[model samples]
Target: MSVQIRNLQSEDVLTYSLPLLLGDVRPPLAESKISVCNRRNNTSMSWPVYNGTFKALVELKPGENIIELMFYGEVVELVLVYKVPPLTRFVRPVYIKCHDDPHGDFQGPEDEDCSAESACQRIALGAKLIQTLTAEKLAEHGFGRKTFLLETDLDAKAPACHVFTSSLSVACAQQMTGAELWLKFACELMSAKTFTQKENCKWFCFMSFTRYEAENDSLPKSHIDVLKQTKGYAALGGGGLALFSTGNLHCWAETLDQVPLRFTDTRKIDRSKFMDDSAYRGFYWANYSTGLGSSLHELGHTFDLAHTRTGIMARGFDDLYRVFIVRPLRSRASSCSRDSSRLTTPSPYSSRSRSRVASGNSIGAEPCFLRPLPTRLHSQPSFPDVIHIEVGFAQLPTKLTQCYTVHHYDGSETQTVVTRQSDGTETRSQLTLSPDGEWERKDVKINQLDAGKTGMQVTACRELPMAPSALPHSAVDGPDSVQEFVLQGQTPSDAGAHWHRSSAVILNYHKWFNEDCEKNQGSSPEITGGYITSPCGLRLIELRNHDNGTVVHHWEFLHDDPPTEFKVNLDKVKDVLPADCVECSVMVEDSRGNISKKKVHFDDL
Candidate 1:
């Protein structure tokens, strides 16, 4: 018997192909999922081909195979083509559901077989459905600093945490080795709670997982529930909160074909024949555990330690024992060449828990419940009332200390000032009080002090805490440390471009001008990298101390690169310089830089 098959003629097939066309890119009409159908019988077709081109394909029977192509959702374009194969291959109806984790309902079903010509239509529809679904999910979360997302290589069982101001999210799966490192360096080490007067810090966190785990693993549910219970952990850091509604976290999951974050690639760690493979696997396992340990060992880095051969906090460990025992060195010298005596000796004040602590001394836990406490929710109060006054300064022989009272209406004002100290104290400062000195008594009541109508600006007297008779002398100061670089201008009318200025921008500017630029207005500035799609056609001028403390240097205007001119813009640079000298510059290719100085003159606006 001879097998004879031929393309189904339009008359023989119920399904007829309609050309897919692009529509105006309206919000609702931007994309969609499509189902091919037969106009005569109004029956749907199954198994349409999906190609990115303007064409779609459907299978048809031996005779007429013409099918009407129907679309739902938004249409970004009208120039679509239908690429149907020869008739005789008609299959069952295709499911018309939105591409959801579990999928959602499409507009309708079709009776006609999917024409081979509908492949482009199918592909376009699938792509549009995916993008639509993903975008809708991302929008549910504000996608702001309060909520962050991370795409990581953490495995299904790995633990992850997202730190936010009002929200927190913990990953359900066990953590990957690098993810553990990120938790230590990004979460535990750099968190604001790890520092005193955390006002100087700002951070948001997120841990991502592979799609298979996010969808199938019950971890997000369990972990998010755990995070929901962790009020104690959340309260420790004002910005700490948890959320598990997956949008930003799961967007990538929808695109990937049910793969783990590292599914496409697995890290190949070089193992030695001299070492046991199980033991080597144990090394990774131990690292995962130790990472959890480091999360708990939140010790603020007050020590200037470095990586030594065999110390906790050292760079590499010989085996699992060292991974648990050693940590990253805090002191620059702590990890340097040393004998066994110097290797593991504890300080006089060292305790068991203190030995392995990270920089903040914060202890982390598996997201869990907290004992409900009747405490006030300390949220940001109304904008703080700031008062500026010239107070008397008493100079000591070694360092000068200034004391002044700023009356607070709500008594919620806080203070943090950098004091000049000896070496090893750059990261911290200690209040030096005499044994006989009154610590609490030193806090003056603003109401009791004599004052002007606005406030009291008193001549501060310097008295020795140790010896009252000793006169406090001031260091002969030269330059005004408080400097201001103003960036004030209207955002261009064409607001299509992205503009992001992080606090790091200020840090970069400090590096740009070095000490010559002095202090910026306020402790930090709000403005950062400036961007625009349309040119406003404006130039910037940099202002410096123009004194003995300042040395003018040549700079240039640059975009996405370091300046090559003799002047710089405080508002334009994307990054900060690493060093303090003008000649000591950031790489042109790298955003790290000594940010330049730019001031808004009365006319620049």
Candidate 2:
């Protein structure tokens, strides 16, 4: 029973102060377990070796780390050196608390620390998890494990609390939509002299004041469909910021050791105790992943990464724990395929009557009187521990080989592990998947809006009002909405292009831009049907379920080309729309940096 570190080029490695995801040796010994001891911290834990592989997150210390891998009886020692990246850019983990709210408490149960300080710690840890995931993914794509840095205090202590008091009353902020809150926070942080010294940086902002008003939440009478509305919270990423709420922060683990146990937790969520802002992903762990994973997805947006067909950039985030822990997402599958999608992370981890002490702190969270897990989860364990190894990592961006492959999608590709030549030396020619198998990722180039250019043009256009849209057809006629409308685009080569004729013409966009540009808006300008100086053309369009913040599809306009004359017509997308697309959002940015994000409901059509 033996498992060893398989991918690092050397036992002595230089790395970031993030979670070290150690993959098992290929054709692993037996399906047993291994003991990992971090000599620096004297923390040791047993990790299960599932299938032909096993993986675990080994925490590293700054400067130097001595990690011991004890397999059954044999022991292998590996040395790792940790260092903060020299890059100036970083992702700041922040918490936004409401003004005049003394408690500054986030949503959580009795034993949990829902205070602003606790929220900062949780935010910092969650930020590292996603940051580690990003690095592992980049390494998987053969990018040498590159990732952004995290901002720390002068003392270099982190999960550092960067608190901002909202000018809006606690009640007002609590009532604002995720978009509204995100916009407000982005505005405040950018203008803050204390926070803006860094010329270019991104943020993982957390809202500590959001809460669900269950009193007004009217779920249908059917007890089977008891999901609630997730207002006042958001899971969006774009521009240089990713925003979310602490409503579900309680589901996240406070310490690293608690991560694995948290992922496999099968307890039912008591809404009063644990806020399931994630709606259907009602388990304690699922909510943890939903909020954390969705936030990472949005952070990808801030990086200017567009959605790919798969990987974390898509919906492959459900099993981030699988990358480190040998546990399946304790989902309950029913005979009804119709409900299978809704049944992810379905029930309690086990049906066996275990003592209530299993829950050390969450009192009575898994009482038998409460609902049970899906009856269909194989009690005997017929599935391979690694079958769901991704959430299975066997996927990609067109190219693949025994080892490495490059992708055209902005340098994104599946990670390829190195194999040994007969001499025991490594060779890139012998590329292969990790002992745990594969991981995939792809993203489009994200670019910041040229707000300076936009400003100069806006100033010039202030005296010259933009012409009303010269669209062949108008798909917008109602409300003066910032996030409701359709968009149409065409290549200069395609003179006959129309929204209904080509997919390249219609989609959506939700973006983040400097608030400074917003103040210079043209007089009487409107984004939708009202007025426009210049149709800044389309740079990128994303199709997503805004409610959950899942980006469905992404379209990018390379070479910075955008259509000069476009239209908003939902009627054109009826036949060519993507599956399950009930609606689409569109944002039109004029020369003045004035952007109008609009939505078109297929139901209305």
Candidate 3:
């Protein structure tokens, strides 16, 4: 007869229980043997027949999981398929005003001094300008398309404004203000309700305009702080971007906080006489056009982009001109690419000099009104290296070994063993790495008959020295060392000796066994019991005596954490045993995977 699968069917879940039975044959089901294999990943599990049935929990990968079942050397196959869930994206817009005037209302072109037809158009133009220059570059660089959308709240006329009553310079703001404070202020002012909500909306673009003197400009520090805070917050759920506008270069002081400023006169100059120094140079000085360029650069930083040598993220007007002016003209032989042409021809700015300044251009008949400027190149960005260490346990019959694996981006790795000396000093020994990039040590021993626990530790580094003087004086700044406890004991002091010869053997143990042991008895560290926790739970096995003490009945139990007082009934196994059975043995396993056994005779019944 062939192997028989009793409870499982096709189309099972990624994680489910599987039950199997030996052929449709004899009275003793103990002879039935089965082996399970995950054909897709080449992983397998085996189980010995227990009583009249066999069962195990199986987990499959996302795609097709081909499971092979072998019973009595006969093979059968089953397939299970799982699918990944779809991703949802959302973009939120936050308008912020950092100015000295609290009652100043946001005005548009339709308003007396305003030039834009509507506030939405003004904000939308900024967003479009940003997308025009960055969308293509980000895609070509393999960072994937932009996943954010900018939607304006038109009915809400004025943007949320944060007033600063005191005189604060850019340097002072950097020293006093933090990103967390800015986000808190923005969230409160904007009435941002969904930040902590369950929805997928997380990315927020914060556009801020300030009326303070450009010399005292300190918004850069705030921008950096906001990005740092938002990135950290994103690790949990939400992230944000801060875009600051300082109005136009004309409103700025000649020198801000002792730094010199340079300006170029663009009035009535012939188109053919245009030179490289035709634009202004001041810290954080940008008219509408340059403001958009600077805003795009800040937005790039929020996207994990580094400053390039010559793109929008590059320093100074020369780089911005290359990105916003020269690059587009060179790419298109005739008319500017639709985006660049939109800026020069129809003009998104209003029909006024201030409006032109806001757009980073001067009023002129010459197309591409912005001219290149002289500026120095900035230093390239730098990144630090990191290493990760992982610890695990490999269990066998007699002993348990602690395994350590150190991973680094660079190929090189080193291992070190630390030992405490008799004179209260510590000594270190370097170990050679195995072919598989792992190091294992069997320092903790298991009696297999007693419940006990022990601790182990290992240190890993990028390099080791042949002489003591070569070692770093301070280990804190050097390689990493990890320490954890290893449990090798059983619970319920009399677990093995409690089994009685009855219809059913009921075993009761503490549910909060490990937690209570750690907190009250100081047996080990406080650990939340789970599949990965050492000495996770207890296991029980039953064996019935057959011909010459050959085992006939086998049963086992494995759990993360048992109840405070739990009982296991074995009536099913008792009914399957033969009347001639003379004796039986029961084994109790502890959370540390240690097993202890007890035997009882039929006469004891």
Candidate 4:
């Protein structure tokens, strides 16, 4: 084979994100075509090498799987193991409708199907895609492919995304703010005994009847600006809930079969084909990247992940396609905007940022609301000449070992969480889930079972058969709120020199446009800037013109007890960046040698 696989070994074990093919190709043979065939499942996937890289979501079966990839007249065989994720807590995908529109039909371009059934399929596909991305990212971070699972429908044998009829009216909801929409869903879902009882469950919800409000143009004989028009109110996440608008559902692929083509699809998002207000959806494929990536950002909040200095938590999910596809089919990246995640807060773990914001924030008309990981194995002597080598079976990544307390029938209590230290902050060591596949969360509202039946992998946290005491009970019957389940995760063992990171952030940035002259945004007061926060302290932060690879701004922080986090401003980048530059990339490195790099399009400011 002229091209070698850079990210994977011959035989590997994968816990989640089944049927996935993610790796890089050796250069020179970069753009050549590669054909991937799964012998056991009789499945075929093909993607052209992209700039010395290749990534795709493929198909596979349980247990031992054989895959053959051929390129440049050479074939490479690979073997891997697929272990289903044993996560008990899951994010339930749901489609809600107003009483008047029970079918839950969403507004969209005529060419697209917006019916309830179609919506369910799209939702299921999107949820699975998210699951795959999460697992792949966790693996990339050396976390061993741990991720949350999605509820499954027994009858359909698919993702269990049910249709919910909300009591609110279309008119009432449209007039309500984003905060109202989120609260409604949280409260309504909580009304179910199952959801309220189980603190582990989270929800991903969308409404069916949010229509675009066409704004009238004031200029005589002038047409309305397509970008100015806004849609129904919805965009919030936190405390076991993630709610969003269905404006971009039309752009989502209905099944995994449609993703490969959808990744490379570049059809212009004209009003004739798309039901949207933000021009950021530059093309059809972008609809998938922005929607899915942004969804990951909102969902991150439900998992207790905070807004970081960069990546999905910020404004960088627009390139989510890069995670699935090495690069875009056509270069429309610069034409796109940061509205994909709709995060409006001053990002980069702002030390002063609000702690408990409910609705979160927004980008353009697209708002990304909030919210809000993982441990040390052993200590190594700081000697300069010592080397250690130990090989053994890899353990699964950190699970929510235990997060809350469970009161038994007798005078005994079981505190389900194991506490640990994470960068000076105390955190919970979670259940790493059940072997039989029943995991956490009572959100299903269906059946009940024990830890073994439900798949709750008992770690050190489960305190069973506690001796009964005659003294009066001292434990509280319940928690103050479901938010108590929102825990700060532990750092992975291998992540010793790195922070507790999830999904290696999506590469985020905030573009500052000059109001006086949109074309002259380069001269804006603040060229571009974002938030930065790290526990290990910062080593360096660099901003460069991606087109020419010229350094535009650079900073180095050297201190013992460094401030938690601070803002990053590139106000002087125009002095060094080429006037014609289209995009730039930001690279941040922590004191522990871990680095994060992401590219953004735009020049001048």
Return whichever of 1 and 3 wins on lDDT.
Answer: 3
Off by over 4 Å in 1: 1-206, 210-445, 448-482, 485-605
> Considering lDDT, where higher is better, how would the candidates rank from best to worst?
2, 4, 3, 1
Give a tens-digit lDDT track for model 4, residues 98-213: 87776778876553567998888888778877777666555544444555656651122534686788888878877777787888778887786434224646788877876654
Arranged by TM-score with the best first, the candidates are 2, 4, 3, 1
Worst 10 residues of 1 by lDDT: 461-470
Candidates in order have lDDT scores of: 0.22, 0.53, 0.32, 0.52
Compared with the true structure, what per-residue lDDT tens digits does model 1 show for residues 1-605?
01111112223312123222221111222122344454434455321112221122332232343455444432211122222222221111111111121221111113111222222222222222222222221222221111111111112121222222212222322232333323333454345352332222222222222112223323222223323322212101112211111111111111111111111111121121011111123222232222221211111011111111111222122121221111212333233232233212321112333322222121221111122334466864767667887779876445334443332222222332334333212122223332234233223223222334423332121110111111111121112211222222321111111111111122223221112223222221111222111121111122222222121211122233322222224332212221332322211111222223232221221
Cα-based lDDT at residue 12, candidate 2: 52
In angstroms, what RMSD does candidate 2 have relative to the true structure? 19.0
Clashes per candidate (backbone, < 3 Å): 117, 13, 19, 35
CA RMSD of all predictions: 27.6, 19.0, 29.0, 27.0
Off by over 4 Å in 4: 24-32, 153-158, 193-198, 217-228, 271-281, 328-605
Model 4 collision count: 35
Q: Which ten-residue region of model 3 has the weakest summed lDDT?
A: 460-469
lDDT per residue for candidate 2 within 496-561, as digits (tens), equals 111111111121121222223443445321334322224454433444454443444332332334
- Using all chains and alpha carbons, the TM-scores for the candidates as numbered come to 0.17, 0.55, 0.28, 0.52
Off by over 4 Å in 3: 1-87, 98-120, 142-147, 151-181, 186-191, 194-209, 214-238, 249-286, 305-605
Q: Candidate 3 lDDT, tens digit per residue, 1-605?
A: 35555434566432111212122222335334456687777866554343334443333555778888776656888776643222222233343333443332232112113221232334444454343333323322222222232222111233322232223332333343335435544455345443432142323333222222212322222222223322111101113444343233221112111011111221221111111111333222223334445555555444323333223434332233222211111212233222322223331223344344433344332233222333445654656765866669665334222334342223223455555433333444555454456754333222322222211111111011100111121221112111111112311111111111110111112121112233322122121211111133433333435333323333233234432211223343454355667655543433432334446554442
Tell me the TM-score of model 1.
0.17
